[model samples]
Target: MKKVLLLTCVLCLAASLAGAADTIKIGVMAPLTGAWASEGQEMKQIVDLLGEELNAKGGLLGQQVEIISEDDGGDPKTAALAAQRLSTQEVIASIGTYGSAITEASQNIYDEAGILQVATGSTAVRLSEKGLQYFFRTSPRDDDQGKVIARTIMEKGVKKVAVLHDNSTYSKGLADEAKAILEEQGIEIVFYDALTPGENDYTAILTKLKAAAPEIVLATTYYPETGLLLRQKKEMGWDVQLVGGDANSNPDLIKIAGADAAAGYLMICPPVPKDLPSEEAQNFLAAFEKKYGGTPGSIWAVLAGDAFLVIAEAIKATESTDPEELADYLHTSLKDFPGLTGLLSFNEKGDRVGDVYRVYTVDDQGNFKLLQ
Candidate 1:
């Protein structure tokens, strides 16, 4: 009886191993429960939907694709733990994460473990500057976005502008970029400061900002803070126009600030699905709506979709999951690869090459209207 039991146990273990080998495991790290939960949730949903579609088309490299997800809680310490867990899971690659600081926490872990990472929304310019062979991002760099924001502000003829950030890595980077450009162009920076994030009342900040009396308030912060700023700015009866950076492009901003408060707010970000001219984007939008009952809430989620597509393309083209080979292909070989967002390509530093930011305004109806 003991021998028979041993035989059965061995067979069961072998079957489990076989089942695992039949699928390719990919890791997704996002803030599943945190201030950025909406962004993280959308990122997971988009990647999962993409994986399902890939499997329906016969999977990748003759193996079904499995997404191993971990919640980073939108905190650096939490992201490190998530990355460590993913490194041991036999995942060939990882996709995600939204905030720049959160992504930075996991970047070294993946690189040292020989896992290729494609960041979806972390846009800090220094991320690609580190020369990590396995690091790449679908999001444009902060410097590029800064130029766009500065130019848009200039076009609006705002001589004096107030720059605000939440002191997060991503927010501060963007604020600095726009600030430099605005200064060089002789635009007066009336006020420049960072706000403590996750605060309920920005009334004190707004009170200080109102004193500055700038023509426009350029907020380089995330949706949550931006939403509060907008709502509070209205309550304080400050009519100064507010312009936001890419991080403020989520639908939750409108929900947080309310349509009346958010209306006419300008932002610079990548074009959303409806504005994407490619048939590929249109088709993806249709498929996403069909499956999820509506389109994604932000362009950041669509950027995640692009990240997944590029990884899949690299795997299919090279026919290998080796990190070095995949990175080499992405850096040297891939060019104008049609992505859900646009033609995606990477420079030697692994930054997506192309100007991706566009100026958009929030309408009274809570819709993002493309200005350019």
Candidate 2:
């Protein structure tokens, strides 16, 4: 009995020590002060909520976790600077760089330092091909999104389509990929025009498109420009069906367009929030609303939460601050770490796999539901 008591005491001590973690640093790089600011703020909020939730439960490895945030301001130069700064801060993992442009710029910094970067929303296709050993993404990139968009449009039997893009890397790439799919399905390109984003006047563009009279107008651009073009097109009485990529999926786009929004404007994006995975997602949505007093702008947590969870798990697994060791553990261990988005696994190049998305529609009543 005495031996049993001593052994039990030692076991208890080990179990207690096992749950305690030191302060593990996670870096957050996102556009907190630009057009995409809402997404960044939502991500940061949920990341904080996760910290609170985890610490309240047991804390990570006995020590509490802290996330250090950096604002990329939606610029590549600033993003690189932010990543470099975060790297210097010695954070064990990174959770953002919310756009392809930013991710493309900042990934090099993390790669060189052997730091793990889990981009939440940087969906540009080339991101996966950089051979960055420590780079991985929690979100699906544009190519996956593009295929879904094209497939949906083709299923609808819309043959005549007009393509309008911002000519930026994210917009142009997805636009071209989407167009290729449409072509394969025998859809005719009525008008393919690349517009300079943030321009005040698209009157000529709208007028030209109205004359072409295409059955569908596909926009692959950010909200500001999308909203402007949509509002102008309505004012000019161009009544073509407007479909957009994920970039135009912002709920605020309708508010920005006001009464000028077309009656049946369909925006192709990932699955809507309520349609996401299990009760964990719903709980996060509820808690986020309870704390922040608003709905999340997009499915920001789908990206951000996965990034945070992956990093925390890696830190707990390796129990080391060395980025390379953490990355190695993640590459091996992430095979079973189910994400709200999907099952997350990575190839050697650190590219994500097994993410599936659905189309969402923005109707006149502001109801965003999965496209049936």
Candidate 2 lDDT, 1-372, residue by residue in tens: 999999999999898656433567788898898888877887888888888888887767667787899999888899989998998876778888676787889888888877789988777888888777888887777878788878877877887998988877788888998998899889999999888866788888888887887888888888778888878888887777777877665666776777446447777766656777777777877887899897677765457887888788777787766778878877776686766655677767676776466666666676666765
Cα error, candidate 2, residue 30 (Å): 0.9
Best by lDDT: 1
Instruction: Return the lDDT, model 2, position 229.
Output: 80
Q: What is the TM-score of each candidate against the true structure?
A: 0.98, 0.89
- Candidate models: Cα lDDT each: 0.92, 0.78
- Residue-level lDDT for 281 in candidate 1: 88
Worst 10 residues of 1 by lDDT: 271-280
Each model's total of backbone clashes = 0, 7
Off by over 4 Å in 2: 1-22, 259-262
